[model samples]
Target: MSSRVLLVGIVRTPRQRWTKAEELEELAELTKTAGGEVVERIIQTRSQPDPATMIGKGKAIEIRELCRRYEIQLVVFEDLLSPTQLRNLEDIIGVRVIDRAAVILDIFALHARTAEAKAQVELAQLEYFKTRLTGLGIEMSRLGGGIGTRGPGETKLEVDRRRIDQRITTLRRELERIEQERQVQRKRRSRLFQIALAGYTNVGKSTLFNRLTAGATVVSDRLFATVDASTRVFKIDKKITALLTDTVGFIRNLPLQLVASFRSTLAEIRDADLILHIADISDPKVEGQIEVVNDTLATIGAGDNPQILVFNKCDKVFDDSLFTRLVARYPSAVFISARTGAGLDILQVRIKEFMEKQMVVKSFTIPAERTELAALVYAGGRIIGERILNGKRQIRIRGFAAELMRIRKEVRKRLL
Candidate 1:
């Protein structure tokens, strides 16, 4: 049976002009994604969360009564609660209380597919659980058969903290090794122009990635469908080949532990030649989502990379006037619907133009016998024109100037 859930939202700071009601709606959506049916919502505004309980003590009791009245089985907080506050709140409310971080982790646990993704999620969960391990004995005991408890030593819930710490260290080393392997693969693909799709979760990044490359990456309306980075080589034109990567979606107030744990997975974005910042234009919080993505990029030191703004899900917006206003505000932005293939061709054309502007032109002639040299040029860049004359093959190439220089050197070595 689906768990009956109550959502409690707390804003430590007063709601300013920029605060939107959409954040609370997002929290509700998160609860639903975790297989919880939200029966009640409680919002509290305070200078800071109560020291003893995340919400004020009276508010906690009120929520407890609501839970009892509505038969709520779980209470989800919209903010990350301190370990002390979590335990206190659970004791007062007489029910399991989970914070936003835990909810996000639960969704990740449910959606993780690959070994690397599973490992990364587990590592982040362990780190989060370690912080909240105190007074969680009862909760852990009850969690023997749930989505969050699918880890090693299921029987040892109230075990020594030292063991959990040791496991975290071990996982770190293993992840480091995995990261090194990824670095090697990254270096191998360094010759190709890399474009990474990054934006708020469920903003149609995976959809666009799939459309562009004919990939079957899982695309959903839910948060964080593509957690681990997925890269595919796609031809922009007959002459231009580039690597497109879809990465984990960003969210507001994402756990610091998660960001730290997924550093290796996110390194691809840092190394990318261009970033496609996709936003769900239909979402009411599209501007806030953009800010969150930009903040995450800045945290990862990829803020300086060239970026193209893509407003996706345009088909969902019916008002032409609103669309025109958005376009006027973001003149460089392109609107498209990956699901319906709307404005995709325009997006592709923009990409091609941007790429062309970054390319340099060069000419090379090789003997017909040196077919290998011609092949390298063809694979590495756009052959503007080519011809065979007098037992020699003449070709004109247009691409990244640095790439052409490297190809030229490799071809010369082959001739020698």
Candidate 2:
């Protein structure tokens, strides 16, 4: 049975504008993603969120009446709410109340596939619940299906909040172990130029990732399709190799707790040599989405990384005048449609050009028995030219200066 949900969006300040009616539409989509139907939407404007209720007290009373009249099972707030606000709201509404963070967690729980992704989502969920446990303990102990109250942890919600705390601690330790393993693997792949795909949720990052590397990660029109970091290698040119990583998407008002929980996963983007910031060119909120991605990147300490602005979904933008305006604004941006494979060659050329600009050219000669060294260069860097003369192999390789130095050290170590 689809749960009937009432959505609320309270604009705290004029500075925090909500021009994107699409956000409400997207919220409805998200509700559908979690198997809920948005029966009504309530919007309010205020200088600050009401301490007792997220919306104005009058609005809260009205929403309570609406819930009763429409038989709304749950009320979903578009912004993050404090524990106190959540408790007070639930008390008045007499229905399950949840903030945006909890809604995102529910979607993540539904879509989690691999063990690692499942663990990460569970960890995030537990962290979120830890803060809201007090409010939920009384309500969740009685209610079953509602906006924030759905998940595996539903029935055994909190036998004891301390037990949940202990589970979070254990999960963090387990995630740390996994993170250590990932660090080792990252070190091994450090020789390759790493590029990460980043953008607002549902902006075609995974689609482009699949087109670039032929990797079939879950591609969907929904938000946060690719939760876990997925990495694959692609040849930028005959003489240049690059590894591309697809990471979790960013959203407006992203939960800080979720960010903290996924820090290890986001480290891939932070450590990348280049960031491909994909954007949905057709999205009316493209500029706002760009700001959100930039803000999230800054929060994660990846603000200094070089980025290529990729204006994707060009196929959807039919107005040539709008396209021309976008191009004029971002002259160096690459326009593409990952779904239709349009403008991919231009994107590939741009990436290759960036790689070439950063590359250091080197020439080396190795004994015939040292073909292993040449193979390492081909795998770890880019082999531009190679020749076998007498009993030695002469090779020319081009790659990042740091990678070249690392290769030189490895060759000397192996020979010594």
Candidate 3:
């Protein structure tokens, strides 16, 4: 059964970044994503939030009466609430009250699939649970199916703080082990150039990955549909091969624990040779979403990587003039519809150009019987052609400088 949810947004004077209406709209979407139906949205304008109840005590009382009349089972706040505020609001409101952070964590838990993703989500949930140990009443913990009160919270209600802390430590150790294994693999793969896709939620990075590799990715219209990074080796024009990775989407705001736990997963983007910075051009908040991704990249120490601005979902864009203006703003950006495969040719050309710019042209010759050298050349570079000279195979190639240097050393060893 879908939960009947009442969403509350307390408007502070001169909202700094996002408007009240946008906040409420996003709140409604979040509630819906958590399998809840928003029955009402209430905006209370105030100089400041009440210390006890987020909205004033008098307003809380009135809202509680309305909830009872409407049979609303859940109330979600647009802002993060202090422990005291959460406890006091629930006591008077007579329903489950959850802040925005909890709702995001619950959605992440719901979508978690792989072991790494589950472990990360568990660690985040435990941290969130630790803070609410004292303030949220124990009785309310048993009440199920409400925002922030459901999923991992119910099973962990009885565990003491120390046990939860122990679990957190254990999870972190397990993740560290996983990260070590991944690091080893990355070291092995460093010879190959890597390109990573970083973007806001619901952008077409995964879709583009699927199209490029002929691999299936679970695509959806929901936010954060994929928590685990998806990576595949794809060839540009069937010669230049590089690792293409799809990373977890960036959001407007994330709790500190969530950010810390997910840092390991984003290491691919950090180590990438180039980043495809994708944005949903059709969304009204396209520019703001781009800024969010850039800020996240900077925070994670990946701000210096070269980027290709990819404006996806071009088919959905109705304003041609706006598109043209954006093109002028981002001269190198490629506007494409991954669904329709439109503008993909131009994107491929751009990728090839980036790849070529990173390569150093060279010429070498290998004996016809030296099949190993031929294979290495194919794996590590774009071959110009082969020639027959004095019963030997002459190869001309262009590849990354480091890879060419490595191959050159191997050839020297064989000659000696």
Candidate 4:
């Protein structure tokens, strides 16, 4: 059975850029995604948050009545709640109280399938609880089971701080071993052009990744559907083969703990040759979401990496005028629908153009008898043209500068 949930938010300023209503709506979606049914939303106008109950005592009383009236099992806050706030709210509202970060962590725990992803989620959960565990002994009796009560909450949450620290150390060691394996895999694909899809959650990054790479990564309409990094070979053309990676989606005010825990997985974005920044063009908050993705990329040290702004779900835009305005606003952006394969050809063209910028034309001369040397050049790069000069094969090829240098080194070694 789904847990009945109520959302609470505070409006700090009289005149705000974004109203509390919008934030509460997103919180409601997050609650739904976490398997909770949002029964009601409460928006309070306050100059500052109440240090004790977050929504003040009066609102807390009203919420207590609402919980009784609606049979609400959970009260979700639109902001991060301190240990004091969480405890007081649960006491006043008579239900399990959680903040936005906790809900997101729960969703991650639900979707995590791979061993490394599970480890990362568990690490983040422990780090989150390490601070909140104090004074929650009474509340633990109430949380029989629900969101914010998964991941480490199931088994390790009731333990002491010492045990939590020991578990964190173990997870770190395991993640380090996994990261070393990823490093080896990355080195093996150093010659291929790498592309990573980065965007806000539910913006269809997995859909686009499958469209481009012919992969079967699970795609869903829920937030944080793709928690783990998925990579596949992208065959752009006969000779142009690139590696494409789909990373976990970014959200507004995503928990810092998650970022710290998933650093190894996010390294795919940091080290990509090109970043395809995808956005749901149909969303009303597309502009803000775009800014969030860019800020996240900068936070992860991938700010300076080359990016192509890709506005996806173009087919969902019903207003042609709005579409035209968007086009004029982002002249260099590629508008595409990954579901229908519309404008994908154009996206591939853009990728090929970017790939060509990293390539250089070079020639290698090999003795006719040394067929192995000529084969080495073909293996390393695309052969544009070849001919015979003075009984030696002259091969002209276009490829990455590093690969060309490697082929050159091999030729020199064979001649020596």
Candidate 5:
């Protein structure tokens, strides 16, 4: 059975970027994704958050009554709560109290499939728990089992701070080893042009990944449906092949622990030759979502990378004037429906254009008897022009710097 959850938001006089309703709505969706039923939502308008109870003592008491009336199993705050705030809210409300970050962490823990993903989620959980343990000390040790207390939290609840620290150290080492393995794999594909898909959670990046690569990625309506980075090689044209990676989606105010734990995954974006920044054209909050994704890209040091702004799910949009306005506003943006494959040709053309910009022209000759070397050239680059000379095949090629470099190394090795 799903846990009955109550969503709570604090509204300050001077509002932040997202309105109260929008923020709470997103929190509600997050709650549902975590297998919780949002029974009710409460908003407290205050000058500022109360240091002790977050929503102030009076509102906390009111929540106690509401929780009893609704049989609320969980109370989730829209914003992150300090250790003291988390403890105090649970004490006053007489139920488990967690915040937005915890919900996101729990969802990551639940969706984690592969060993690396599991390890990363566990590391993030332990890191979040470590923070909760500090300041509150022994009291936080009493946290019980449920959504926020899954994964490492379930097994390590009774353990002291020292044990948690030890586990954190161990996970970090494991992640470091995984990162080294990734480096080796990256080196193998260093010659290929790399494209990474990055965008807000549930913005159709995974769907587009499947469309572009003909690979299956479990698609869902839930936020953060894709946690692990999945990479595949795709041919842009007869001659141009590149590596495409579908990376974890960004969220507004993503948990710091998650950011630190998933550095290996995000590195794909940082190292990519190009980025496909996908956004859901059907979403009313598309602009805000775009801004959040841009901010996240900047934070991870991929801000200046060449990107094609792609507004996905255009099949759901029926307004032509809206498209005209959007085109005027974002002149370089591409509109496509990843589900129905609409405008995909244009999207591919955009990608091909980006690929061409990074390519260089070169001329080389390989012995006619060495069919394998001729194959290598074809595999690594586009044959702009070619001619057969006496006992040799003279080739003119266009490819990325790395691809041409590999071909040169191969030709030199064979000649020697």
Candidate 6:
């Protein structure tokens, strides 16, 4: 059975750019995605958050009554609650009380399938609980069976700090090995143009990735449907085979625990030759979300990488005027619907054009007797034009600087 959940938030400033209502709605959506049934949303307006109960004592008492009346099994805060607040709320309301980070962590735990992804989620959960393990000994009794406890079971969580530290150390070493493996593989593909899809969560990044790579990655409307990095190959032009990676999506105010845990996974974005910043143009907060993605990229050390703004889901947009303004603002931006393949041709063309800028165009000729040398030249790059004259094969190719250099060295004796 789904847990009946109540959402609590504090509206610090009514004149804020975004309203408390919007935050609460997003919180509700997160709750639904986390498999909780939100029964009601309660907002407490205050100059500042209450140190103990978060929503203040009076509101806490009121929520206690509401919980009983509605038979609410869980209460989630839109903002993070300190250990004291979480314990106090659970004691007074006589139900499970978790903060937004916990809910997000729980969702990650739910979706994690691979060993590395599971380990990452577990590490994040432990890191979050390491500090909060105090004062909640009794309150966390219910934690033995619930969403937040998915990665680290009750037995592991109940252990002393020493055990958790040991486990964290183990996970870190494992992730290091995984990262090293990734680096070695990346070296093997150093010749390919690497592209990564980065954007706010549920912005159709996975959909676009699937469309481009002919992959079968699961696509859903829920936030964080893709929590692991998925990579595949796609052709930009006929001969330019590029590697495309779909990373876990970014979100507004993403929990620090997740960022720290998913560092290795996010390295795909950092290492990309180019980033495709996919945005849901139909969303009202699309611009804000785009900013969030940019901030996330900077945080992950991908700030300096080349990026192309891809406004996805344009088929869902009603206001073409907004799109025109967007196009005007970002002259190189591409609008496409990954679902219907609309504007995909344009996106591919734009990608090809962008990639071509980095390539070195060179002309080379190989002697007809050097059949092996001709094959090497063709393998090194896409041949734009080729002709045979004066008993020699002349070829014009566009390719990576390193590949061209290697080809030049291999065919140095066959040069014409």
Of the candidates shown, which would achieve the greatest lDDT relative to the real structure?
4
lDDT of 6 by residue, 1-416 (tens): 88899988787776652576687887788788878899998877788888898888888889999999999988888888898887787778877788888888888877887777888888898889877775354735555566465563223343366678998899899988988888898887776888999999899999999999999999999998889898899887777879999989888788898899888899889989999999999998888899999998999899999999999998998897898889898898999999999999999988998888889989888787778888888998878998999999999998988778877976885564
lDDT of model number 6? 0.84
Choose the strongest candidate by TM-score. 4
**lDDT value, residue 151 of candidate 3:** 45
Give the per-residue lDDT of model 2 (tens digit) for 1-416.
Answer: 88889998876565545553467777888788888988999777787777777686778889999999999988888878888888888887888888778888877767666666666777777778777765653735743445555544323233356587788888788889989998999999988889999999999999999999987988998877778889999877676788999999998877777788788889999999999999999998898799899999999999999999999999898899888888898898999999999999999999888877887889877786887887777765667898898998888987688888887888888888
Tell how far residue 405 is off in model 6, in angstroms. Answer: 3.8
Model 4: runs farther than 4 Å from truth? 135-139, 142-144, 152-159, 409-416
lDDT computed for candidate 1: 0.82
TM-score of model 4 vs. true structure: 0.94
**Clash totals for all models, in order?**
0, 0, 0, 0, 0, 0
lDDT of each: 0.82, 0.82, 0.83, 0.88, 0.87, 0.84
23-141 in candidate 5: lDDT tens per residue?
Answer: 89999998898889999998877888899988988899999999999999889888899988977877778888888998999888878778888888888988887877643324555
Q: Return whichever of 1 and 4 wins on TM-score.
A: 4
lDDT of 4 at 284: 91
Q: Write the per-residue lDDT of candidate 3 for residues 1-416, one digit (tens) a residue.
A: 88898888877765533577787787788778888999988888888878888798898898899899899988888888888888888888987788888888878777777888888887887788677755566644443445565544224322466677889889899999999988998887888889999999888888988877788988888987888888898878767888899888887776667888887888999999999999999988898889989999998889999999999999998998988889898888999999999998888899999989999987777888888877877666878877878978888888898888888888878867
Ranking by lDDT: 4, 5, 6, 3, 2, 1
> Who is ahead in TM-score, 1 or 5?
5
Root-mean-square deviation of Cα positions for candidate 6 versus the true structure, in angstroms:
3.0
Candidate 1 pairs with clashing backbones: none
Misplaced by over 4 Å in model 5 are 14-18, 134-144, 152-160, 366-371, 387-393
Report how far residue 202 has shifted in candidate 6, in Å.
0.8
lDDT of 5: 0.87
**How much is the lDDT of residue 78 in candidate 3?**
86
Query: Judged by TM-score relative to the true structure, which candidate is superior, 2 or 6?
Result: 6
